[model samples]
Target chain A: MGKSIESILKKYDNCSRDSLISLLQEIQENEGFLSEEAIVKTGKKLKIPTSKIYGVATFYNQFRFEPTGKYHVMVCRGTACHVLGSLTVLQELEKVLKIKAGQTTRDGLFSIEVVACMGACGLAPVININGSFYANVTAESIKEIIESYRKKEE
Target chain B: MSIQIEVNGKKLEAFEGETILTALKRNGIRVPTLCHMNDFIPSGACRLCVVEIVGNPRLVSSCSFPVSDGMKILTNSPRVIESRKTIIELLLSNHPDDCLYCIRNNNCELQSLAKEYHVIERRIHGNKNSFKLDHSSTSIVRDPEKCILCGRCVRVCEETIGVSAIEYINRGSKTLIGTTMQKGLNTSSCVNCGQCIMVCPTGALTEKNQTHMVQDALQQKDKTLVVQYAPSISVSIAEEFGMAPGTDINGLLNAALRKMGFKYVFDTTFGADLTIMEEASELIQRITEGKTLPMFTSCCPAWVKYIEEFAPDFIDNLSTCKSPQQMTGAVIKSYFAEQSNLKPEDIISVSIMPCTAKKFEMQRETMGRNGVKDVDIAITTRELIELIHLHGIDMKTIQPEITDSPMGVRSSAGKIFGATGGVMEAALRTAYKKITGEELVDFKINAVRGFEGRKEAKIKINDDLEVGVAVISGLGNVRALLDEIRNGKNDVHFIEVMTCPGGCVAGGGQRIGVDRSFIEARTKSLYDIDDRETIKVSHKNPEIIELYDNYFGHPLSHKSHELLHTCYMERDVLL
Candidate 1:
């Protein structure tokens, strides 16, 4: 509702085929993820086929095809976080939300995303949900954190 | 200017800026390649074309390596052969071992390569891929597990057809070709031209098998099964029987259909003649009224769908006449049913076409009347061959038989609809006579006849009406013309667009592994018939005249409009 895909596309010059990635990025930034409609709309704007746009988007791991839930959970899978048992925490988070990494919950209240590093090695097994960090998180501790978000959404 | 290059110790002249593969090909040397499509930029993804260069320490892919002056290369060096063998072995490592059950078992390029390279054992075993087959499209099927990821289908879809309905989805080993959003092809921008199936090196792409439904229909005692083969099938089907390419077996086909229990065997050329009558009249009406100046021929279903999806603005410019296949189906359901005193539901109308798009076309919601489809099933030329083989009919021993009366007689102009630029030539023949009120001095308009993608000509219908015409084959050649029309370029009066390059003679559903000479031969067979036939124009066809006398009063009559023409609407796709 913030801006129609057509309105967002009107900002870009149509001639440049090189702007496809940046245009998709901008749309994903606005809409939280690249919707099928957004990809098709962007393809029409750039005179490129949607299959090609999706191909380019899928080549990069950064792009997501699904929208983020209201509470976006980021589980750091950095070198420090991995050594500190963040994998267990991530597994627990996925179990609690009943969704895999990079997937939103069925109710759209919670989503889980795997990140490389949060640049906070001291916080080792870091779990951030909606910008609120739960540092030194354990597998048991992640469940309570997810419960708190679901309760807060209610 | 030419450059000298040494191959296998023999010096040869090569064109400047030509690839090593091109030079070698000119010198009658063959190097194996997987991803090298003709007239397309080589991707060099498959290293099977690797050759040993004298100066370079590493083997280079001959398909991408540019030929230079005094370049020496050994195409079949022991090391080069070993490298190619290893590449094939590695490809087969993860490939499914169900070649016996595959549709393209004997004709498969990968299997042929494996045999050629002596890949006798599972040299490098890897986890087999288990991707699901995509059977969403009515015309085409996608089996990703059998795909070698050659990218020929992707390139042909994007480059040749101008509809990038499929593309590379992911990166590296995980990369696979898929439609937008990994959804099925039905939701994608595929026009169902089946050009992808033509370029696919393996059994990954094939026409949807409708032969089973045909077999089922043949068994029904109460149903009257009528089969119509397109104009191109007569010339193209001979190749499937090990006969010479472009061998006209139209009479033999009628005999075979009858042998297979088909009650009536009608020629689609008669429908082509009917299309010309209606389409020529529509063009004349549009020209006289000065509306829809350049009437686009809607004979190609893939081209019609492409306009409906990608270029909807030109929908108004498209002639309202249905293609010969549908026109034949409609007439068979209505007029033929009435004549035979058979109910429309009791008649099962099947079509044998040199196209995959006809399968999708017959299923269109608008192609039927009161929920009874005009055409019950559409099969490709390949499927017809299968049916012939399945019935164990001896083609060589079969005697020639004549087609049924009334709807089977066709002019040579109608027969030429199989070739590119044929619709334009046929339409111009009738349009000239309609506009000038005189038979054309020479029925053949050579200007529009060719294998070229685009052909343009200006003809003097009369002093005041010198109409411009353009004949285009592939959809790739249409963008510039469409842009011209959008920019108010009004020189052209009629445009004929066939989705497949070189028209239905080289259609997507024709025999695979065929070369350009076969297409040329098939095209020449049609022209050869036209050269000797007395009835050169569609209007001169006795059956078409009799049809107007009996059923519809004339071309563009209300009854004709109801059955012989249809409307197009804008279609939204994932693109």
Candidate 2:
């Protein structure tokens, strides 16, 4: 893991701090999460402070501090989604999962978070349950969607 | 003179010196084209407008090809379509196909043209351009992946607004639209006016929206959501509701606020009038005290931000009077809260502005008072339209009603605050009267009015006092005037500068669907409103004048100066 992290950082040796963040984001997307050993190796290879590497990882919403669940639920909170009652859909998810936004369920079946404008104004309340878009969602529909995810996890 | 042009064996009549594309368009001929904006010089990079000329072996771009007498043009031959299709296919090869998830998805001209041409799939997806999003400024966002490198935004920034904050960085396929030194937009010489966002054909440039935060505030029971509209918004919001341009929807707007669950629906124009009272008094004090001569109006946040970032030397010349939107925010947080017996934190002040820079202006440290930010949220007229649509409000059928009293009652001087030279004219109306101790029999001061890039006039006060006034819109125009002043050619006693081209009426955050004629018509309506109003002078505004005499000390008093007159800081070093 450390060797892989060092190689990844070496690939972007000439990149700026912003570029490093982008590179780390891409790496995290592929690996699911950044381990402590991977972060130390990245810092050492990139010639940046470990604290600085952690700071960049924590700054953006796209960067996750912890490992995500097998199933990730992203509910859009953009203007269009809000208008179409995306918050209600989010609320239903919280109630069912017994967790807040950005928190995975106790059973590790779901992880939920809100995103800004997903570019769907007319079709609001867009739910990305397991990387698949479920547009024009309602509270009832959200429940049905989550049930499918739960059954898959089981 | 009529020029004969042959189009694929068909004779067509065109003017002597029109571009082939324009001549073709005038004759009801459709040609596949892009990168040819109506407002700026044509950059024939798209190559979709390539036409076969009779005498020329190679096809020429119709947009850049000038029509000559008896020139033969073939716009839509099989060969031309194939070339155009291939050009479009190459454009789509690296372009993102997630239109439903793009901000300008439906409204994008590029997307519409793509669908029209049926170039749905890309043959090549190798080595796609990967661009990280830049959300540095409060007014504008840059998603480089969406940018087609049309250079329209860059041209508009340089040619129109005269703020060349954005330019092409790197070279070729790696070329990206960014600040000169890759600085954060706020740190760059960006005025935060958002004119670049207006001309962008895709979702590459957009206003940083706080609509979700506003929605959250609206849902909170403890929070009192109060909204105020700038002078320009009343004249233009009607266009968003599909009403005729310049339709006065003040009543409907007020009624809509009630329907939208707003605790208070107020007008920023009242604060505009208040600004006149304060600014006029400050001008008089500056003249008498012989302190800062030729004071610049600071109402336009874009101009204020520009002066703060680039021209810090002229900070002393900036009139301390807070912008009307900020004035409304300050008043709502302090005076209005005291009157209503509500905590400052309970009141969520939102301004519906014609400008985007106001979003950044509201976040400045000087805007807040008593540990609470003066304004909680700032949404543009466009965002307000979206909010109205979300609530299913039938704006067309709703009858117009009056804005709330005291904070809503505005004079003609306040109404014209939307247009160029309006603030200067308003201040002059009150300043001349206050200085001479007589009414301005001729209320209309045409000296500062008009659409000229910059205008200057000398008004002789009581035959002994000559005060020079200048009005400038567009940051580039302001830069020229300021340069002249800096060179010791300072003849003007007062200067009013608005960052937008035509002023707030043609602001960066107004409705996008309206045509130039409609915007002009709406501007005319704003002027008409001022003309029709009985109260023509800012000093004559009973509410503001009463407030000055009672709670607040008289205008120019130390207390009034402290509360109303705020100073600008130099942001040059920070930048």
Candidate 3:
């Protein structure tokens, strides 16, 4: 819907349907998240149905439909994190942020997303907020992390 | 190349590139399958078709596994049986336990497979999925709890209907088939074709039942119940009555409707004839006047809705004639009611169609007059059969009866409106006469008479004018043709598009578990009637002629336009 999205689509002019994912990735990379208009436009560019585009986008957790909040929180649910009881920490983050994974809070200040892996598996129960990593996070530490983010926002 | 394969220790001949399922089917060996649809690419999503192969440790899904020379397959060995039973049990683990009251109770493929495999008790217990029932669409009801996630509906919607209104959303354990943005189907690009319902293996999809409304109307003493059945219903409804496929029980159907307390019964074929009168004349006018060149037939509601939403650019090209069902409903409330000395408001006009989309079409904004719908309700062929059963009218014992007088007569041309290419053939019959001032020597146009995805024929009217026509069924086949038309391919003058393959005879509202042969039989029956009948063109029907003479002066006349035609607009959807 934006001029940047249009420029990204222009690069894939006359491209076959096989270029759909890369095209979608480029749009999402520039737009932060895919909008309904973006998906519809991508479908038109790729000669695919919007329902199929949505299906593909929803299948991959990397593609989010909503824009990120001011403080984007990423909770790792990787294999190592799961074994280290990060599920409680993820739930605690969701509760503290008042939003589910891949959703933003109503205040537009905090958002939560769960990642498969952060590649820092050594930090088992890891939580990343705005590119800064918090290692070995517990349910109690989730509130403190949120409180620090709220203080920064204030 | 032909190759030898051993099935259950017996040697048999099979094609080199053929699947093991095909090889086994050719040898008359039955293997239970769920995710496999005939003539469709096998996804092997459901492993129920797994069979044992000698010297192979892993069991292979015969539907997707290609047969090779010296391949020894055991279709029903102990291991294969156990694997199939386990698959059915696992599918039932998360499935709802309401098969007794489900719409597809006995006809469901999943329930049949479970019974065949003898899945007595739940071997694997899991939490039942809690999916909200989607009753958002006027034509279809989606119950996700009963969905087996076999992806047949998803495939049929995409590959067959070419309207991927739904797809598998999310990944792994969270995956479920849904429309765009996880919204209801009403907001999606769904055309309400109901082909997904035909392919759904479980009770996940069914027509929105309207039998209760028909019953309620029957009980109303003040309502004058007037009914009309589509051309395909007589031939297709016989299968539900234990009669042979393609059986012509038109007289019996009329008698049953009358027995069910209907004040009058009519045939929508009469309306089909009326449609041909208007449609063919509209085509001739368009061609001569140099208006829209490739005029698309607007008989199939699903096709109409598809063009409205998916191909809005072609909205002007669509013939403005109301479909045979809607035309009949309009005529019933106006002309027929007037003839019977009744008011339109007192008439409860109902239509029986071989389509679920008609249920949606009846509710369209333009399909009514003065806030009174042309049709009070539209029931499918299946619902009509149910109503007969509910009224305790024995179809076998009921005497064959004729339709109500004055407006009930139909020619064989109208009767053939059930099959693919039927509208084209019917319209051509009358259009030929109207143009050349003489009847066609050979009424049957063989070029447009088959089950091909697309059929094209150039009809010669005079020395200078040759009208090219195209007939295609299944919405999937229209995309390429539409693209070509957009690219300025100007040969085709008229196009008849039916949403379901093989047309209304094999519509979504017809019986389940029917194959291509059944459809062929129904089509053959319609053709057989056309061959035997004297009145084979819509213009020859005395009733239609009389209607024009008495009320509507001519085809596309001012009065006719007010009742028999409507306009379409660009319908907005999520893409």
What are the candidates' individual DockQ scores? Answer: 0.85, 0.02, 0.80
| Interface CA RMSD, all predictions | 0.5, 13.2, 0.8
Q: Which digits, one per residue and each the tens of the lDDT, describe model 2 over residues B1-575?
A: 89899987889999987899999988889886667776567899678889999779999999988999989888878778878877777777777777898867678878877787777677656457888788888888888888888888777776777666766765567777776335557666688898887777778888887778778888998888888999998888776667788887888999997788888989999999989988998898898898888899999988987788667889999998889998888888777888888999999889999889999899988888667987889998878887898889998787777777558788989989999989988998899999999988888888777778888899877776789998887777777777888899757889999888779988988876456787688778888887888999988888887777666767767765555667778774222
Candidate with more favorable, higher DockQ: 2 or 3: 3
Better of 2 and 3 by TM-score: 3
Q: Which ranking of candidates, highest DockQ first?
A: 1, 3, 2
How high is the TM-score of chain A in each model? 0.90, 0.78, 0.94
> Candidate 3 residues B1-575, lDDT tens each?
99999888888999999999998988888888888998799999999889999999999999999999999998888988888888888888888888889988888998998888888888799877677888999999988888888999999988888889998888977778888888889889888888888888888998999999999999999979999999999999787778998999999999999989898999999999999999999999998899987999999999999999999999999999999988998998888888888989999988998899999999999997997789999998878878888889888788999998676899999999999999999999999999999999999998888888999999998898898999998889999999999898999999999999999998999877788888999999999999999999999999999999999999999988999999999988976
Candidate 1 local lDDT, B168-271, one digit each (tens) = 99787777889999899999999999989988889999999889999999999888999999999999988778899999999999999999999999999999
Q: On a 0 to 1 TM-score scale, where does candidate 1 land against the true structure?
A: 0.95
**Least accurate stretch of 10 residues (summed lDDT) in model 2 chain B?**
B179-188
Candidate 3 segments whose C-alpha is farther than 4 A from its true place: A1-3, A95-98, A147-154
Runs of candidate 2 exceeding 4 Å displacement: A1-154, B6-18, B22-33, B123-126, B573-575
What TM-score fits each model? 0.95, 0.76, 0.96
Candidate 3 fraction of reference contacts recovered: 0.90
Q: Could you give the CAPRI-style class of model 3?
A: medium
List model 3 lDDT by residue over A21-124, tens digit each: 88888888888888888998888888888999999989998898988898889999999999998899988888877778999998889888899999999998
Superposed on the true interface residues, model 1 gives a C-alpha RMSD in angstroms of: 0.5
